[model samples]
Target: MKKIIALLFGALLLLADTEFAEPKPSIDNPRKIVFPITHGDDESINHVLSSANNVMKFYGPEKVMIAIICYSKGIRTLLKKEKKIAARVRSLMTYDVEFIACGNTMRTKNIKKEDLIEGVEIVTAGIVELVERDLKGWIYIRP
Candidate 1:
């Protein structure tokens, strides 16, 4: 009887371990986030960047991927000549936050490609990119 009980207990422990083991996150299936910054001012833009950085800090880079789409007046935030918020924007790159500028907005505002900050990539349209990201399960953030 003692031997049977011990064997059952060992089997139960093995079964529980397999059932309750924590599942690991897949790097290929990371969480997606998109921040659409349409504001031109320092306060709103900085708030958005700060909030994005906070999210990255809380979630860790391994589990989350971040993208910022700048369009319309928000394109002004990425001007290389404009030193304001440049450091903060640069810092986010280290956390894997990608900054995408709207090509249409650049042409509409008469801003040249050379005028944009170094790390920003030019997308066809900011709104279009955001929508595509939404389709791919990215959560939208407007701050």
Candidate 2:
């Protein structure tokens, strides 16, 4: 009975480890940063992108893991109809930057996966995603 309980607990621990889904960090990229965007303005989006760009430039692409989580109006940044910022987003993706969209906003705004840009990942809740990343030692940037 003791061995069975230990094995079950181990399995539960392994499962718990997989709860926070995001890009894996390594020794090469020890710094993790999460950008939380709730406003859909172009300036805000660009500012966040610029900050991310600066970080990458400072640390070199291989030394940083950056993720942008968009919720509420910020989802506009990843919309398929959003062409103005697509170029900038695509440019960042080249350096392994991640863009995540909020499913709650998608449901309220009627946005489907096909409605988002090619590489945008959809998470259940953008704020929750931000919290998880923040708890996992990621620096939070509002811009």
Q: What is the C-alpha lDDT of each candidate?
A: 0.84, 0.86
Which tens-of-lDDT digit does each residue in 2-73 have in candidate 1?
999999999998887422223333366666889988989888788888889887876678777999999988
Kindly state the number of residue pairs that clash in model 2: 0
Tens digit of lDDT per residue, candidate 2, span 46-123?
Answer: 888899999788767887899999899989989778887888888999989999999999999999999888999999
Q: How does candidate 1 score on lDDT?
A: 0.84
lDDT of 1 at 89: 81
Q: Show the colliding residue pairs in model 1.
A: none
RMSD of 1: 10.7
Model 1 regions more than 4 Å off: 1-26
